[model samples]
Target: DQQVKQNSPSLSVQEGRISILNCDYTNSMFDYFLWYKKYPAEGPTFLISISSIKDKNEDGRFTVFLNKSAKHLSLHIVPSQPGDSAVYFCAASGLGGGSEKLVFGKGTKLTVNP
Candidate 1:
């Protein structure tokens, strides 16, 4: 069973527009949620993150929203640019026993068309 799920495998958007990627989780123990962007032949880099204590976190053109009760989270990109096109991953982690590991979703490929 996947603890984190990204139902949409892909998304396409026009340049200078907005892109929204959704994610769901089955684990209630998840206290931290993060979004990572990966380009082909490269590692996923940290994008934005939100703690369970906060419902939203934003940085630059990226924003992350978390809904604890629904076990859901979403990432929003404003003014999407071609450079923003990449595989977006949703990850969750919880602190326990002085250790924590992240559980990530498969990923959603975003295409930004010029």
Candidate 2:
């Protein structure tokens, strides 16, 4: 079974509008969550992360929210710009028994239309 899932395959938003991406996971053992943005032919670059203890984390225009009880998470970009258009992936890792591995969602493609 897939532990991580991105329900939406794509999203389109107008420039200067808010862009929201959603993700869900089935693994309750996951303690750390991360969001990464990737461009074509390039590796994913880490964007934001949140520990299980924290409900939200923000940096500049990007924010990540975690709902541990629901096993869900979301990423929000306010006043999204053209450059923000890219494929975004949500990743989760658990620190159990001193072993940790990252499980990632397929990804959601965000399109910012000017």
Candidate 3:
């Protein structure tokens, strides 16, 4: 059972355009949402994240929003650059109870063209 899902397999955006990536989850037990970015031949790097208690979190050009009632989350990258192009994965964990286990979505490949 895929608890987390990234419906879109890929997304393309022009450089300097806003890129929005969406994610959904079926598991209501998740209390933490995380976004990770992975480059070719490299491990997934930690990106922005949001807690179940927070509706939104922003860091620089990246922002993450969590809608607990809708069991949905999204990542927004403003003025997307080519360097921001990567496979973005959405992950969730029951961090509220100290559980380290994480459920991840299949990921969406983002291509930002100049």
Candidate 4:
């Protein structure tokens, strides 16, 4: 059905602490996984991504891990800051010649307390 699922609607963490978000997908054809962070009324910014061929990808404070066997993926933020409070969306797409639009989950709102 092309559905990516993020079970948690929200997460809260203290500043300088680790924040983790989880997501799941049912489609086996999906070959790319992406994470996007969004601020209020602003477009989502690309955070990190992993291809099905790889298990882990990291970018500074952000990290993404993919488990192809379980059709699951997760995003981790190290030393979360007050500015990190925003919505996180997990997305996936299949490899194809034509346009493969990304399918996003409901999104998780992360709050970082100072």
For model 3, give the 10-residue run with minimal summed lDDT.
94-103
Give TM-scores for every candidate, taking all chains together and pairing residue i with residue i.
0.95, 0.95, 0.96, 0.94
**lDDT string, candidate 1, 1-114, tens digits:** 999999999999999999999999999988888999999999999898888899999999998999999999999999899999999999999773213789999999999999
Q: How accurate is candidate 3 locally (lDDT)?
A: 0.93
Model 3 per-residue lDDT tens digits across residues 80-114: 99999999999999867425888899999999999
Model 2 misplaced regions, further than 4 Å: 96-99
Q: State the weakest 10-residue window (summed lDDT) of model 4.
A: 92-101
Error of 1 at 54 (Å): 0.3
Runs with alpha carbons beyond 4 Å of true place in candidate 1: 96-99
Candidate 2 lDDT by residue in tens digits, 2-40: 899999999999999999999999999888989999999
Cα displacement (angstroms), candidate 4, residue 13, comes to: 0.4
- lDDT per prediction? 0.93, 0.93, 0.93, 0.92
Q: How well does model 4 score by local distance difference test? A: 0.92
Clash pairs of candidate 2?
none
Better of 3 and 4 by TM-score: 3
